[model samples]
Target: MSVFIEKKKRLSNDSISQLEDELEDNPLDYNKWIKLIKQVMVKDKEEQIRNVFTKYLDIFKLDGEQWCKYINFEIGKGDFKKVEELFAKCITTVDNVELFRLYVSYVRRVNDVITGGEKARSTVISAFEFSVNRVGIDVKSGELWNDYSEFLKSWTPSQSWEKQQKIDLIRKLYKKLLVIPTEKVESMWSTYTKWENEVNSSTASRFIADKSAEFMEARAWNIEWNNITDKSLSRKVLPYGLDDSDKDNRKEIEQQLQYWYKWIEFESRNNLNLKDDDLLNKRIEYVYKQAIVSLPFVPELWYRYNQFLMNGPSTEDSNSLNMNIDILSQGLILNPKSYLLSFQLSELYEKETNLAKANEVINNLVNKLIQDHSQIIKQIEEINDKSIVKTQNINGDADNMDEDDVNKPKPGYFLSEHDIKSLKDLKLTEKELSRNITLVYTKLMMTNKRSSGIKESRQIFKQAKKFANIGFELYVENALMEYYSDNKKTANKVFELGLKTYGTNGKYLLAYLDYLIMVNEIESIKVLFEVSITNLLKEIEDPEGVDDMDTPVWIKNENLEKINNHKYFIKRLIKKYGKFATKFLDLGIVTSLEKRFKKYFPEDDELELFRSRYSYDSIDLIKYDLGKSVKYIEQDTRGDIDQFFDYDDETFDKNKRRKLDLPSKPKETAVANQPVIETQNGFIGESIYNLLRILPSASYYGNVEDHVFNSKKLVELFNSLDDIRNQ
Candidate 1:
């Protein structure tokens, strides 16, 4: 409540009021009066001042700066009408044609935001008319003409407008300036072209092109020819008798030639709606002419010409093919080591499937290697003699060997692993084809006993593995060879070792998984499953080092910060295998089968039986359970229990039915009439094996029940057996 002191700034309202009265009579006194009026008006008086300005819009001839000030201030107030009025007043100012255009443009821009119809259209049209007729204006004022034209176009059309009428309007506006000074026309042509392109109407582009051509021609052709070709100005001549000072002139002509050549190339490439025969003929002629004109001896053009003639009706004309080959040969002579020419000749022969000549070229390359590695060949031949001696002792005389004996190679003694590796490197030394060598190794394995040697197998695996490193398909075959040669357990161990060493890179990951599945290595399969799941979780959560999410198997992560900070890993786990795999795990189906097989078939060697030849209907599981339960019946007997345990396709008891039809049998006799049983361990084991033979392959994995709808048959079969026991 203490006394509040206020300091006041002095103002001359009396002077401002007098000037305002003068402005009211003739508001065009903008330069002398407007700035002073604005200085005295407080922020609160903005609306009152805007009202006065709007009322006097027609009478004012404000300078562009003062007028622009009012328009911008009014726009900030959202009083678009006042902005348009002030903009109109500004453009009508006599001087500062550039400023007039700039202010008018600002007005149209604001009008576009808030006004439509005849008011906006007429305002823009007025600006265009002023800009086109103005002299000594900024070059960019012509650009304002374009903006005004667009604003006028947006008006609701009169009923008189036809397709051609709208086109002519744009044409007439553009043509008005077409006859303007050439320098100005040239400067404005680019702006006009830009405006013309933005218009969607079809006729606009053609109209712009015609007008631009007219403007360029007026500027370019108006000069006398001697101005461009005055070569007497040169100071010296080069050895070719061309003037050094005229170099720039010659370059200009060359540029023109290049420009025309580019257009020809474009037309030839697009061929838009041209007829097939015409297009072909036109393209061929262009290529042929281009070859003759530019660097006349270029080889690519010659090849293209040859391709065209052969592809056309003149293919049978051997003359053109021979001519192209001659050109290629000449080029080769100049550039002797050109790989492209050599490859082309090889391809031409190969395309005809003329393998003999292809072999001849390939053999020449291989023969060079043989000459270089004569010592290695001698050692390889000596190794073969030792292998043949060992094989001959095993098979008795070689003459009586199996029919496939001819397919077997005479075995070579690889005295050491180094010898095999040395032979493999010989091909690379002479630059012989490596891929064909892999194929040859494949044939040697299939056809020759020499392939059975352990050192030799290791050597082949090494070469195949090298090719696989480069992504060849032959590595899978080599992995299969290693798999089949050993105890199944050892093969699984080797592959597992390989996987650990290889880091489970994606390509090798797929190959390794495929091999495990083929050989029924379930334990290794489970390990891989865990590895893949862990990889998915780490990638989805932190994603720091994962590569190439573009692979089809991967999905890119969005929302990096959220993914890293949150636990979205469970969702990733569910997504990886889909719901079905999760369901199997949750229901304990997989665990139960693994446990049951190991428990009941403890000593069985055919652990892979579950995976082999497994086909069954829903009823088969019941039969399997019945077969397993009755297996014990043969175990406690002493007579040959083999028949009881030995199973095959189920047979009906024909003799039992025949006896029933004949007469009723006494109980004592029936008990005594049962067949004698056997009890030796070997006999019992053999019978158990026989029983297994008839049980479909699936009975091995406890998958028998899955074959019958999640073991519904097992339940039924168990219940029926319990009923019989109770009776």
Candidate 2:
């Protein structure tokens, strides 16, 4: 309490420590990713450095700039195998132009005509083709196309067949590039025209004439593309780091996102009437890649892109489904917090009848939710003070006084040991998060039902109950599933279970009462009233003169509100039913079926004049906007919901049901779930497997498992061959 000079505390001056501290506060900060990488690069321990890189890349896997930095670091180390491994991990997900340039650069570095000869030249050509196939459609992919052209022109052949082959390859590459509406297509068209004339004077006219119409069309679009993207700034506009305090930058970022979205609309033919769906989808898909490369952290863009791909004319194409899966998976890596991408991916897998993978997507999402909730709870515990509790934002600074209010010493109020436990768990307080988890649980149950029947769905329900943060909706949904299955006893039991936990919850109570009324269960409804009222009565009285009770005003109000909600519900019930329908209706002087309403809430006309009105006959019904109705279970391969998993008694084999283990991060689960491939040296799962083998990563680079130059096993084989040659 003494007004003395306070000793200044100091922070560690170490750069790595400093960066780590900042990253802990905001992990998605792009600048920090760069600075931290640069800082760690100067260090000698490869393993430690690799660990740090992996840690960040797990979150920012689609960020092309960061991927290149890691790839370049590996290239400098001369670990070609490691470099390929790193590329494999990144190549599948990220569709960045910069990353492709690095890929080609590495190709040129290791495989050159001077030392490595024709085979190396062929390899380089293959690499360029692979890179061009995935990203050549991009407007910003001008440089990569140019590089590929330069490499082709640099080659000369010793044979007649080779000369013709080279010429044909050049024509093919030029024809492809000239028709694409990229930024540098016009310049390339000019160069191609000149080269065609130089190659064969007689056929140059025909070659030039063949592509002229398409070339002109592409050239017009490229100019129009530049018009739509005035001073085109998608690359320079970095997001994920700007704070609310930096208002100008935040505004700029928002504007940039809007601009990109508008550009996407333009590409998608929102303004233009491009009668060709195939050409339109391609253009839209290309723009989506460009936008995604620039704004990897935005989940909405990924989701929108997936929707476009799924709904477009391309859906009839065999590859569309795989394309959707790959896009959604990449989005999941960057934005694990987003529920949209996960739900979509899970549904897609379900559509494909891959039930295990469908469940895994949801399982992974719930796991992420748990991990995130745990982190939030830990942060709250660390920041929560014994005496002083910040009244506004829990995570904000305690000193909340304005400039003029500096004289006001007390910024926060006081808290007691008992008052700290939230009326609900801290985890459940995140309402949006809780709602998403509940939807996931419902989706999980639906998936289980579709696969193994109601027996499995019930198992999933039990697992969902283990999480404290899930909403009453899961119980509501589970009860409906049983009710729809014509298992009245099981449905009633599920409702009773829900009421026991959420006894005072007005929404769940109303829904339960409605179902009871719908089913004409008068006796069971009476039992519900008796059981639910017992616990709710404890908090029915208002607290005014009570002392030493440091109960926050909100909790007291909540209690009053709950009691009033029950009163209003009974009011609605009495309005529907007769006043003397039962003992509760007949005996009570309040003239209602609400048992203790007169005694507990005495009628007072004299005190009716409230300074603040109690307001509203409205009772909140808990509704999460689930796009798909949970109660509607359609026909599956097994059978209809009516015939699926029928139970005779009040029992199913609990032992027969599969257990969903608490999951790790999605990426970790992916690696750990890979099955062991049997080999001559017994069975061993390849530990070095990366997501690059994922089909979606390289749209054009079809099934490039590994290059021999980047394999240690191949290097050993090469050394042995050299030894044989020397002998």
Candidate 3:
């Protein structure tokens, strides 16, 4: 044993040395740095651990996990002052709920050790105040508040004045916590009421008066909560924590149901009188009805609705019972495979002293499931036989026919032989249908309360395993059933089988990951992460290709969908694990994956703009008004021209008019000598002679006299043309 330990220690030291050398060359390798820190931690050398963490954090200050580990290490050393100092630094550095939670937990531990001393009390109080200020608005702040209240409750003041002060502070804290819109609002209120009840027993009238005001405040706050939820619902705002990018309408509706459920619970807990009870019941029913309308197939809502009716004041009424039955019937009709409602119906019948009816319901359900299962099996056999016979016939026909004859066009629609064959293959195969039937049978048997339900369920599970093409959902269900039945080892084995079978599938891998997380199997999580990332990348690399001509439209679409789902899963993994996902992040693959994500699941406009700034051209100039008009000129017409002239008419007088000293009378030429008639089109065209003139020195100049002469000559020329035209 000592030799083995020495060998393991040597290996650890060697690994640390290698990582240190690697880090010296590539200092920013996050994983290498983390590995070195973990190696140092295993040695339990406080100074070495501190130095390594300090060095890594000095370079990578934003690493929350490293900061947390540093603080936790100090905490483990039981050095409260150092822990506090570390927390103070970390709270400023990392804006995370986990850090605040750790601080609160540390303060609570210190207070427990020191009991009621002034210093300990002040320290705990100040820490609680700081945590509340830091993370009060977080959804999980309820835990912090609960811990604070518990800490305050544990304080035992020696004097009456001190006790009063403590009570006042606790009440103030509770009042503040009550107003926050957290999912745990109800729990906070419950704690506050319990505290108030204890105070009321001690000082009756004073406590009542104080609580009257607090209760009023709480009532107002609850009304505010109602208004906020109503407005959000009206605006179609998704519930907090649900991903809007997923575009899952059912999930959004289900989240809304959660909100409604909480609201109903709040109202039920706060009802004080007949009027309040009536109002609360009415609101609950309205919300329940609304939820069911949107999510008719959700069995939980139906179950809740039925429970509410049964537990209400009308429970003794036969009509109320009938109403519950009717709701369950509707739920069962909408979701025939929902064993929950079926079991509930049977239980209700038994509660009413109708064991016969209860048994009848269970037996009928079991018989129907068994009959369906048998029929499916028979159909599968028939399909197999038909397929075999058909294949043999095709083989025989092919053998008898020549190649040309075999290739000859068959009399059919526009589909080619390959397309027809693909279409024929698109249906769910016999094996798949058989597995689905077995799954349904297993579910029914599991829900049934008969003597042989467990035995039958196990048998169905075994039968399901016989089919090679069983769905991932079936495997998951079987594993979960085993886990719930306390057969955890078997459940784990089932999950292993599933991973072995569908290792390339993200759905099964993610389901298994979730189960591991739930079970806190950290080592298995790491191993699975490594395996899943490699397999997922390979699947993304070599996706199934569907030939456009031969593949059915649905099959092609399903393949495309699978590819997109793989991309989404990869992105989700990166987001969940951050630097741990580095092993999977080949630069090429990441770039392509990001492009695919952007194409399929685009972010909001602002986010996309920020991300795509370097990749695409920006809209530097956005026009908000009508743009300038385009000028269209005729081919022979001159384009728009602005004319400018100098005023020098005297230049025209110095230049002799170079009149074409032609014949005095009109002469015919090859070109028609149309009379020089000027049309007054819009503004009359300015004569070139008036605009400029030739000086006696043979330079062009314009003066006032020249302008006047050209203007008078143009008028006379026009008058002469008009008179000649009239003649």
Cα error of candidate 1 at position 276, Å: 12
Candidate 1 structure, TM-score to reference: 0.21
Predicted candidate 3 versus true structure: per-residue lDDT over 1-727, tens digit per residue: 9997886777687887667767876565555787799889998998888888877865555345567788999888988788777776657645455667787777767666365578877887898898887666444467877878888888788899999998999888876777554557776766677778788666644644665554565456555666746644421222222222446855776557766676567556653332456655764665565455444546787888888888899798887887787778766654555657878987777677675666566655555555555565565455445544554465467668777755442222234456445444534443445455545545544544243444556666765566445567777887888888788998899899889888977778888887977786767876887688777777766766454464446456767777777876765554333322233334554454455446545662333322332221212111112221112224312333322211112221222222121243232211121122232452445464323221121111345565445677889999999999999
Expressed as tens digits, the lDDT of each residue in 167-256 for candidate 2 is 999999998888777788878988998999899989999999998988888888777767876755567426552334587867776766
Using lDDT as the measure, what is the rank order of every candidate, best first? 2, 3, 1
Question: Would you list the clashing residue pairs of candidate 1?
Answer: 28-61, 383-413, 384-412, 407-447, 409-448, 638-677, 638-678, 639-677, 639-678, 640-678
| lDDT scores of the candidates, listed in order | 0.45, 0.68, 0.61
TM-scores, all candidates, are 0.21, 0.63, 0.30
Q: What's the residue-level lDDT of 561 in candidate 3?
A: 79
Q: Name the candidate that leads on TM-score.
A: 2
Model 2: residues with Cα > 4 Å off, grouped in runs: 1-13, 17-31, 44-49, 77-94, 114-123, 152-173, 189-211, 231-233, 236-264, 270-283, 307-327, 349-357, 371-385, 388-436, 468-470, 523-727
Task: Please estimate how well model 2 matches the true structure, expressed as its whole-model Cα lDDT.
Answer: 0.68
Error of 2 at 183 (Å): 1.8
**Relative to the unseen true structure, what is the C-alpha lDDT of residue 629 in candidate 3, on a scale of 0 to 100?**
18
Report the error of model 3 at residue 271, Å.
Answer: 21
Choose 1 or 3, whichever is better by lDDT: 3
